[model samples]
Target: MATSRGEFSSSFGFIMAAAGSAIGLGNIWGFPTQTAQNGGAAFVLVYLVLAFVIGYPLLMAEFIIGRHSRSNPVGAYRAISGGKPFVPVGYFGIIVAGLILSFYSILAGWMVAYAVEPFFKLIGADDMAAWTVNQGNLSRNILFTSIFYLLTIGIIIGGVKSGIEKWSSRLMPTLIFMMILLTIYVLTLSGASDGLKVYLLPDFNKITDAQLILSALGQSFFSLSLGVGTMLVYGSYIANKENLVKLGVFVTLADIAIAFLAGLLIIPAMYVAANTGTEIFDEGGNLISGPTLVFQILPELFNSMGAIGVPAALVFFILMSIAALTSSISMLEVPVSYAVDTRNLQRKASTWVIGGFFWAISIILVIYFDKLFGLVVSFTTQYSQPLLGLVICIFIGWVMNRNSVLEELKKGNPEVANSLFMKVWPFFVRIVSPLLIVIVFLQSLNVF
Candidate 1:
C-alpha cells in the first residue's frame, strides 16, 4: 500500500464530499424520472429499503477495502488480495469510471447550456420550441460539453483537499439550499398540490409490479454512486479515526433527502404546468420519460410560471450544474488516483491527460447522441455497474480475510467491531448482496 496520500481536512469534509458524489444527476434527474415512471411513492419506498439493505452493505464493503488498502482501486485490490489475479478488478473499476464520466459529462453539459439559457434569452422566448431544437444542434452541444468538461477537469486538477473537499463543502449546502427554496416556491404554485399527491401517494398495484421494483433497485444503486469505484476511491481519503458506519448513513440519508426534495419540486412543477395547459402526460396519459421530462416538460412547466419562470429555470439549472460537477469531480478522481498511485504521475498531469481524453470522447458522444448515447448508457449502467458490484462484493466478503476487515472496521469504533453488524454484515455481503445484485443484472437484461 502507498504510504502517502491526501486526507480529508475533517470528517465533515469527507461526508460532504461523499454525499456530493451520491447527490448528482442521478438524484436530481434520474430519481425523479424513475419515480414518475414507476409507482411514485411506492418506488420511493422500495428504493429506501434497498438503499439500506443492498446499498449500505455494499458501500461498507467498498469503504473497508479502500481504508484497509489505503490506495487507489487498482492498488487497493492488489493490496488487499496480496496482488495478482484480483488486480484486474481495480482496473475494471477505473475503466467503468471513465465510461460513466464520458456520458455523464454530456448530460452535465446540457445542464450548463440550460443554466446559460436565461442569459441568452432562450427560456421564455416566443420561439421556445426552437430553443429545444437548438439544444440538439451538434455544435452547440459540443461547446457546452467541452465547457463542462473543463470545469470538471479544473476542479480535479486542484487535488483532493483543495479541489473536491473544499468545493463539496461549499456546493453541497448551496445545492440543498436551492432545492429547499425551489421546493417552497413550487409548492405555492397553483395545482402544485396535485403533483405532490401523485408523487407521495403510493399505488399498491404499481408498487407490486416487477418492473417498478427492478427500477427502484437500479435507482438505489445508481443514486448511491456505487458499483463504479467512486465510493471506494473516496474511501481512501477518509481519516482513519472517522466512523465508516456513521459516515455511510449520513451520505445515504443526504442523498435520499436531495432526491425526495427534487421529487417535491419536479412533480409539483409538472402538475402546475398541467394546470397551465401544458401536456405533461402523453395521449395514453402516461408521464413522459427521460429527456422529455427534463428538457421538454420542465421547460414548459417553467414557461407557464410567467416571469418567475426565467429565474426559476436559471436556479434549477444552476443547481443541476452543481450536482453534475460534484459527481464528475469524483469520477475524474478515480482515474487520477490510479495514475498517481500505480503509474507514479503527478496529480495535475494525470488529471489533465485523463480529463482531456474524456473531453474529446464526450464531444463525440454529444455529436452522435442519437446513435450511441443510449447504447453506452445501457451497457455501462446495466451490464458494467451491477457486474462490477458483484465482483467487489465477492472479493470483500469472501476473498479478503475477514479478520483484516474487522480490524479495519474497528479502527474508529471498537463497539461496532463487536456489534451485531460485524457478525451479520459479512454474511449479508457474501450471500445476500451478491444475489440481489445478480437479480438486478438479470432484470437489466430482461431475463425475468
Candidate 2:
C-alpha cells in the first residue's frame, strides 16, 4: 500500500482551499446567470436550501470517504469498497476532472487576457465589438491558454501545502475584498436600484416554474464543485480534527456568499449600463447570458463609467483571474495527487506529464471552440456531472460499510455521529440525494 499522503497543515487552510475549489466561474458567472433567469431571489432561496439539503451532505460523504481512505478519488473508492466492482466510479470521477480542467483552463485564459487588456491600451477602443472580436483571435487564445496551464502546473509541482493551500489562502481573501469594494462602487451608480430589486426581491409567480427549481438545483450542485472529484481530492487533504459537517457548512456558505456578491455587482452594473443607453439586454428583453454578459456586456457597462471604468474593469478581470486560478489549481491537483499516490511518480514529474497533456487539449479547445466547446460543455455539465454525483452518493450510501462511514464522521465530530444528522444523512444520500440528482439529470436531458 502507498504511504499516507500529506495532510493540510491547518483547518483554516483546508477550508480556504476547499472553498477556492467551490467558488470558481461557476459562482462568478454561472450562478448569477442562473439567478437572473430563474427569478433572482426566488432562485437564490431555492439554491440555498438545496445547497444544504443536497450539497452539504454529499460534501460530507466525499469527506468521509477521502479521510477514511487517506487517498485520491480512485484509491479512496477502492479502499472504501474493498476493491469491489465499484472502483470504476472513481475512474469516472478522474476522467470528469480531466475533461473539466481542459475546458476550464481555456476560459481562465480568457480572463487572464482580459485582466491585462487595460495595460495593453485595448480597453480604450472606440469600437468595443471590434475589440472583443480581436481579443478572441485564435493565436491570442492559444497563447493565454498555454500561460494559464503553465501557472496551474507550476503550482501543482510545489505540492499541496506550498502550492494550493498557500495560494488559496491568499487569493480567496483578495477575491472577497475586491468583490466587496466593487459592490459598493456599483451600488452608487444611477438605476442600480432597479437591478437590486430584481435580484433581491422574490417573484412568487416565476418560482412555481419547474424549470426554475431544476436550474437552482443544478447550479447549487455544480457551484459546490461536487461531481468533479474536486471535493473528494480536497477532502483527502483535510485533517481528522476538523469537523466535516461544520466545514462543509462554512464552505457552502462562503461559496454562496461570493456568488451572491457577484450578482450585486453584475446586475446593478447592467442596469447602470442601460441607464446610459447601452443595450444591456437582448432583443427579447432577457438579460444577456454567457460570454456576452462577461466580455461584452460588462465591458460596455464599465466603459460607461468614463475614466473610472479603466481601473474598475482591471479590478474586475483580475478578480476573475484569481477565481479561475483558485479552481484550476484544485482541478489540476486531483490528477496530480492520483499520479503521485497511485503511480509512484514524483510531484514535479507528475505535474509536468499530466499538465503537458491537458495543455495540448486546452489548445484544441481554444482553437476549435466554435466547433467543440458547446458540445463538450453540454455533455460534461448535463450528462457526466450528474451521473458522477449520483454514483458517489450511491457508493457512500449503499456500497461502503455504514459502520465505516459513521467511524469517519466520529473522527471529525463524535457528537454528529450520534445525532439526527447521522440518522438522516445516509438515508438522504441513498434515497433523497440520488433521486434529486436523477431529476436534475433528466431535466438536463429534457426528459421531464
Candidate 3:
C-alpha cells in the first residue's frame, strides 16, 4: 500500500482523482438549486467567470504548494512557511475536510437509500409529494453511513496508485458517460428547451448581485475541492515534473462542464414537467435543499417522462451516488493518509480509525443534529471554505517564491508567447483572488 506520499501512476490518474474530487453532489444537487435561487442563465454566466478567474488561480496555487512541499497539508505548511503562522491553515483544511465528511456521509447515505428504494418499491407510493416524507429510520441512516465509510476506507487502504487513482479512473468515466446519456434523454422531452433556456441564457443582472457572487465563490471552491487540502493532498502525490497549469485547467473545465450539463438535465426537465419558476429558487427553501431535490422535485420531473421515468431516475441517482462516493473517498483519504504519514499508523488501521470517528460523528448529525447539518454545511460553503482558500491563495501568491512555482508550471508548455503570467496571474493571485474571496467571505458572514 502506498503511504501518505504515494505517487500516482500517470498524469491521467492524477487528473481522474483531482476531477473526481471536484465532481460530487455539488454538481448534481447543489448547482441546480443555486441556479434556481439566483435565476438560471444569469447565475450560470457569473459562476463561469468566477470558475475561470478566481477559481483557476487558486487551483494553481494549491498545485504549487503540494508539488513543491511534496508532503501532506500539515507538513507542507511547515516546510513552506518555515514555522510561519499559516501552519494552522493546513490543519484547518484537515479538520474541515473530516468535519465535512462527518455530515457529508449522511447525504451519501441518503443517496444509497434512494438509489435502492425504487427496486424495493419503497418509493413506489402513489403520491410523489407524500413519498418525499421520511421513510429513512435513524438507525438505517447510520448503518448505511457506516457502510459508505467502510467502502471508502477499503479503497483508501489499498494505496494511491492502486486505490485513489485506479478506482477514480474507473468510476469518474462511468459517471461522465452516464451523465451524457441522461442529457440525451432529457433533450428529447417535450419541454426540454425551457430548461435549456433557463440554464444557458446570459442574465447578467441576476448573477452579478453580491450574494450570488458569494454563493458562486463557495460553489467554485467546493467544486474544485480546493479549500480543504483535498487538492493540496492530491497534489502532494504527483511528481515534480508534472504540468500543474495544464492539469489545473483540465480539472477545472471538467468540473464546470459537468456542473453545467447537470443543470441542462435537471432544470429543463423540471421546467418542462413541473413548470418550476423563480419562487422555487429561493435559498434555504425546501425545493432546493437535501433530499427534497433528488427525492421530491426530481421525481415530479421524471414522472412527466412517462414509464421511462422510473429507470431514468434510478440511473440518475446511481450516477450521483457514484459521484458522491468518488468525492467522499478523497475526503476520507486526507485524514487517513495524514495519520499514516505523521503517526506511523498502518493503512487499514488509519482508515478505520478516521473513518469510524467520522462515521460516528455523522450518525449524530443525521439522528440528533439534522438542523445542525445545515449550519455546518453553510459554514463550510460560506465561511470556512473561502477562508481556507484565501490562505491558500496567499501562500501561493506571496509565500512560495515565484521563480520556483513558475518553473514547475513551465515544464510542459515552454512556449509562453503572449501569456498573462507577468500581468494578470500575479495580480490575480496576489490581489484579485484574495480580495474577491475576502469580500465574499465577509458577505457570507453578513459582516459587511
| TM-scores for the candidates | 0.95, 0.95, 0.89
Supply the TM-score for candidate 1: 0.95
lDDT of each: 0.85, 0.83, 0.77
Better of 1 and 3 by lDDT: 1
Give one digit per residue, the lDDT tens place, for model 3 in 1-448. Answer: 2334588878889998989988988778788767766767778777889888888888888877777777668877887744367877778889899988888888877677666656655345535323332445666677667777877888898888889999999998999899999889888777778667766766677755877777787677667887888888888788756767778889899899888878877776666655533233435453354466676777667565567876887788788789888899889988876787767788888888888888878877887765788888887666788899988888878777777766656665554323665457778989999998887787777886
| Backbone clashes counted, model 2 | 0
Q: Model 2, range 1-448, lDDT digits (tens) per residue?
A: 3235677787788888888899998688778767887898999999899888888878888887778887888888777655467677778778778888999988888888777777655435535434433655887788788889988888878787888888889899999999999999999999999989888888878877898998888887888888878888888888878888888888888888889999998888888888988887788877887777888888888888888987898999999999999999988888888898888889998999998988888888777888988877887888998898998888888788888887777787888766888788878899989999999999888898
Q: Which stretches of candidate 2 lie over 4 Å from their true place?
A: 1-4, 122-133
Each model's total of backbone clashes: 0, 0, 2
Model 1: residue 91 alpha-carbon error in angstroms: 1.2
Better of 1 and 2 by lDDT: 1
Q: Which sections of candidate 3 miss by over 4 Å? A: 1-4, 36-39, 81-83, 122-136, 204-208, 275-290, 303-306, 410-419
Q: How would the candidate models be sorted by lDDT, starting from the highest? A: 1, 2, 3
Comparing 2 with 3 on lDDT, the higher-scoring candidate is 2
Over 4 Å off, model 1: 1-3, 122-133
Candidate 3 contains a number of clashing pairs equal to 2
Q: Report the lDDT of model 2 for residue 276.
A: 88
